[model samples]
Target chain A: MSNNYNTDGDRMIDCFLNLGELMLRAGAEVNRVEDTIRRIGHAYEFERVEIFTINNMISLTVISNDGRVYTQTRRVSVAAVDLEKVARANELSRQICAHPVPLEEFKARIADIAENTRHYGKRMRYIASVVSATAFTVFFGGNWVEALISGAVSIILVTCMLFSDRLKIRPIIAILVSAFVMTMCVQGVTHFVEAATMDSIIMGNIMLLIPGLALTTSIRDVITGDTVAGLMGICDALLKAFAIAVGCVSAMLIFK
Target chain B: MTYLVQIIAAVFSAIGFSLLFNIHGRKLIITAVGGAITWGVYLIVFTQTENVFLACFVATMAIMAFAEIMARIAKTPVIILLVPMLVPMVPGGDLYRMMTNLVMDNSGQVRFYGHQLVMEVGAIAFGIIVISTAMQLILKMHAHITEQRRARH
Candidate 1:
């Protein structure tokens, strides 16, 4: 156990686990996460690599050149979708595959990503939130006034979301709180606006929180042979959607 | 006129979701166009077929193929392009209506919206499964052929 071989094996396992955790947190699909880890292990010249990954956890095993076996597992935090990070991680994985980097360099790279990852600015995020709510309102048959009002209210909801996200609140509770806040805001605003009804405004904002696309992607995951990953994703999405419904309903009832 | 508005709505909505997803630059334009393409195809097919399921299925397949091609060309993962592009197609209106009916205690309306939601979501899911599986097979077969040629050498 004192030989250099064990140290190298331990480092390799650490690097692979780091890569897997990065990809999972960046919102890469389960298939992509498993595939990237396996590819990286092969590139590093490991004898055997096996990985089982679902949305919340990744477990990996590798056999070294000298018959040393190493395994590591990581719990992924509930990720907020950040495609820029996904692209960066995808690019890093490809770079590693093309030519393996030292364990230190790989670990440094992961830390660099964590520290210096770029994000859309707060101003742009606010604008995007406003525009997204506006367009969705119109898309769902709301008129000009309703769209504008929904857009205005969305910033408040977006702010709430940002706060909850920073606080690291659980997703279900965050969504429930956000939905309740959003419905409450919409109701208060529409009362003065007169022309705009609560339904269209609420519908527009709901687009921001509903997990419709996630639900669809989960089934696709199942079809692609990632049954566990798919089921976990499905349950997570269904729960979030239900939270939104419950929050909205309870809020509406309170005011009625 | 309404169709034109819907298409434009899609483009902006895609842009918004792309921002929320932390995507920036040229890829943003790609998702924007992909959104218009998605709704445009969905409209054309839906009008002709008068079948919601078929409309969603064809629309999703078309845009997914677009996403795959764009990913290859841009050297980005397909999901980056695919998810934002697909965001506009989500049944937000239907989901809202369903919830509304539930609150109003209108069982009949809730059931109607629920069916629509399931059909739309199912069709899109099936579309993604079929096209992605097809793509995977094609890539695997190509790799196998390449290996065989190398072996011969």
Candidate 2:
């Protein structure tokens, strides 16, 4: 969604590249992204297709029916955990493979999937953040009092996340800043809350920020032998984990 | 009380995650129940084997297989259910404790928890690889058997 470049080309190749870029941004594994592009290209009457995908870049080559070669590389954005987007992209790609569409229609459908599919409303997202963090607090053996505090702290965290997202902030800075602010808020509140340990509270909220998608996707990529993509995913997860740790440690130090 | 809390918490965590991921309809319920099953299986195996890695490995294989079956029925990608199903298996509490130990300069505790974390992650990766490879072989055998039948006929 960041860069829409090179609108003029074999529209069929454009659709293939667009779908690949969408799938990658939506956090599909590298294999899945490459598979989607190849399938879509062949379905559109391309004589042959070859694809190479990593965590953040996808390059594809298609030999059209006339044997003209069209090669395109799309720079993918950082992935997020919207399985809905992935599922939708997968379904769309499959449908196109079964019954190839005109390039114009293919482009439109891909754009619609990118923007207009029903996402969980903002309210639902906020509630989910609270419920998950609170349940995790109890699951982590926190007292009810600590669990309650974790719930309140999650709202503040979610707000920070949404605000940063709206302002188009980079994900790394958003994560690092939110983790620090949330931990500082938790520490400040627990000081007066009598017997509410900071450990369980922080543990519960940390679940919200953990790199679940990157970790899981990386595992799959590695298992599937996409070692480069897998390594990139691992690196991304490590950086995010480090940011969270630095944030927590700094906040704790502030109180110290 | 503790068992009940653990099961319910696992389910709710899955629900929360499913919603956050924008998963809709029956997929949401299946993914949430999948989380509870994962926790239940992990607890049973861990208590019996007293091995963290073994427990995680078994639990992961169980859930991934379950997701594969459900995905076939629902005609959705397996990752939809598989990812959220594994949420409860992550030791968020232990991870936080490890980071805290690092902050406090408790190197011994850091090493302990860090080792445990790596093992759990390794279990998940290996379990997934083993099952997927097995599934592929099964499919290949099935295809070969059908081909043989056609040739015989």
- Highest lDDT scorer: 1
For candidate 2, give the lDDT of residue A16.
Answer: 78
DockQ of every model listed? 0.84, 0.71
Segments of candidate 1 deviating more than 4 angstroms: A1-7, B144-153
Model 1 chain B worst lDDT window (10 residues) = B92-101
TM-score of 2: 0.95
lDDT of 2 by residue, A125-197 (tens): 9999899999898888888999999999999999999999989898878899999999999999989888898
Q: Which lDDT tens digits does candidate 1 get at residues A113-164?
A: 7667889888888899898899988887889999999999899889988899
* Standalone chain B TM-score for every prediction: 0.94, 0.96
User: What lDDT would each prediction earn against the true structure?
Assistant: 0.89, 0.84
TM-score of each: 0.95, 0.95
